[model samples]
Target chain A: MNSVAFVIIAIFTLAAALAAATLPNLMHAALCLVLALLGLASFFFLLGAEFVGLVLVFIYVGAVAVLIVFTILLTGRDSREHRGFNWSGVVIALAVFGCLTWAILKAQSLTIVPPHIRALTVRQIGQVLMAGYVWPLQCVGVLLTAALIGALVLVLEEKR
Target chain B: MTPTLQAFLIVSAGLFSIGLLAALSRRHAIFILIGIEMMLAAANLNFIAFWHFAPPPHPSTGVMIAIFSIAISAAEAAVGLAMVIAVYRHYRTTNVDQFNQLKG
Candidate 1:
């Protein structure tokens, strides 16, 4: 059933995220991150946001993951980092988690009720994006282009 | 609970804390960058899930924000990697702890 699939996806997503967080070797962590991203994309699909899911997978798994692995290959291999959790970090991390848990519950209780909202289809999103939210969308594109140029310039300087 | 949105938020929280730990625990510049990226991903996940559950009346800001976040994240990765390359070139290493020449 759909509900079963949702549960399965949630389990995979959480497991992959935990792996991404805790995986020791840089290479292994990156790999786990790829898995986590893929799981997230699938979750998007299950939510009926197929386009968003594809974009997540495309950008995170296809592009970001490739770029990271590329950097790994370009950098020397012998450089190793010590892997393990510190007591202080764990304590701080737990504190932060507790705060976030409280916030989510508090917010959920106060949210405006809309139990029967319709899922926004891809077509509906396109219409809204182009007509109502065009400015932000275009601004994002411009920023991405600028970033690409900056990356190229920096890389060139590095190579020189 | 029955795997509500709250559960997803908790997962995001755990991942985010892990990310913050990695960012703080390392003096290496590249690892710091990775940790930052992980945190960004966590935030993006929250945005997407919130959008899914809390749709606006007309134009969904959540989807638009998610799209923008993806673009911003891509930009960040590009810039961050470039900075890493530059730092590595100048010092022949990327460890933040090793850089002491500029302390004057």
Candidate 2:
């Protein structure tokens, strides 16, 4: 039963992702993208990453999707381009997939460092994130702050 | 293959490939945004798989990264769409053809 559920979720997620990628209608694609994100969150839950799952729903579906919609609404431009899937692109994509699969398989043969498993919890993460990865985390914060400032400038700029 | 971790892995691979193709071949910026979202989900799936199949002794290993990525990607989408809007305002279109102002 659980396997069935996972399969169903996987199918829906992949279908929605494909729709988001290939659908020419921007609004429809965005809606599909939201669905895809929701499906991924559910997958996370099934896999026991409850916090991660909730974050996916809250951040991707709630914040990111909403922002995309808001931007689309603000533009007031009709998405008129009707793009049927290109057979050429399909062939090319398959080739790319084949090559990537081969590469991943080849790499998989190599022995690599296994992930250390001392503990796994939000509390442990909070400790490691602040103690060991503090500088890098701060760097990420600074990068986001810069991005926010850049966005502010761009949005406030004069339009021609 | 039997339906288990392997099946999920294959589906994740397919999803990631679809995302890559969309990002590479699509002309619209919004399509590319969707592609990025798909790719992020693929990574999240990988995290979940490791958590379920070969997780660390602790309870939070791969899951924390997945959660962080989701939050970071949200900020990414926000700034990304804002820039898209600015670009549209500048050139009156979101078509990728006209977006090559820095071509050297």
Candidate 3:
């Protein structure tokens, strides 16, 4: 059952990712990206990280995907099909994948099965965030506020 | 047999490579941003997988880092998209290759 689910999710994710990477239409690519993100969220669930999975769906699919689509729409004038594939980039990607796969396969310790463990709950996550990770949490809050303001400033119309 | 750590790592690697391809090959700035987001997601998956496969007594470190990573990626996406819009407004084009003003 576990292997079957993993296979299905992996196929779904990789296919959507390929589409997003290679699609000529910007809008279609953006939508495919959402699908791919959904797949990743499911993977997070499969790994027993329910809270992280929910956050992935909320932040990535809900917010980031919408932002990407909106950006595409806002910059729709040059929405024509992209130019031909950059073959050199394809070569580089393939080369990188080959090296990574080789390295992962060579590492024998990675063959072990996942040990059964209790699932992490949202309450515990909150506890950790407010305790051990308090400083980072505060820092992220400040960073998000800065990013929000900076993004707004960037897109704001020039007053000249 | 159930999927092992190697399997997850391989999948993550594949996702990362695909993302690199998108970022490197795509002409549009938005596609590049999508690629970057994909890469970040791949990294998050790695962290979670390792966390799950670790010994019986698990620390919340992996989950915590993943959460933080998600927040950071969200901010990154917003800022990146905003930059794309600003560049589009100034240059009237989203093709990354055409933004060569800084080229020596």
Candidate with the greatest lDDT versus the true structure: 3
The per-residue C-alpha lDDT of model 3 at residue A157 equals 92
Q: Is candidate 1 or candidate 2 better by DockQ?
A: 1
Share of reference contacts kept by candidate 3: 0.90
The TM-score obtained by model 3 is 0.97
Q: Per-prediction count of colliding residue pairs?
A: 0, 6, 0
Poorest stretch of ten by lDDT in candidate 1 chain A = A108-117
Instruction: Put down candidate 1 lDDT per residue, A46-152, tens digits, no spaces.
Output: 65567778888888888988888777566544246554445676678778988998898888453443234467778888998899988988888889889989888
- Could you report the DockQ of all the candidates, in the order they appear? 0.47, 0.43, 0.85
Model 2, A1-160: lDDT tens digits are 1678878998998898888777777888899989888888888777666667777888777788888888777765846543544466667767876875666556653223334333345676678778766776887788779878877987896755
Candidate 3 on A45-148: residue-level lDDT in tens?
89999999999999988899888888888999987656777889899999999999999999988888668779788889888888899899999999999999
| Global CA lDDT computed for model 1 | 0.72
Interface RMSD of 1: 3.0
Q: Sorted by DockQ, highest first, which candidate order results?
A: 3, 1, 2
C-alpha lDDT of residue B36 in model 1: 81
lDDT of 2 by residue, B1-104 (tens): 12355555667777887887777777777777778878878877987776666634545556657766766776677778888888887777777777879421
**Which pairs clash (backbone N, Cα, C closer than 3 Å) in model 3?**
none
**Worst lDDT 10-window in candidate 2 chain A:** A109-118
Identify the CAPRI category of the predicted complex in candidate 1: acceptable
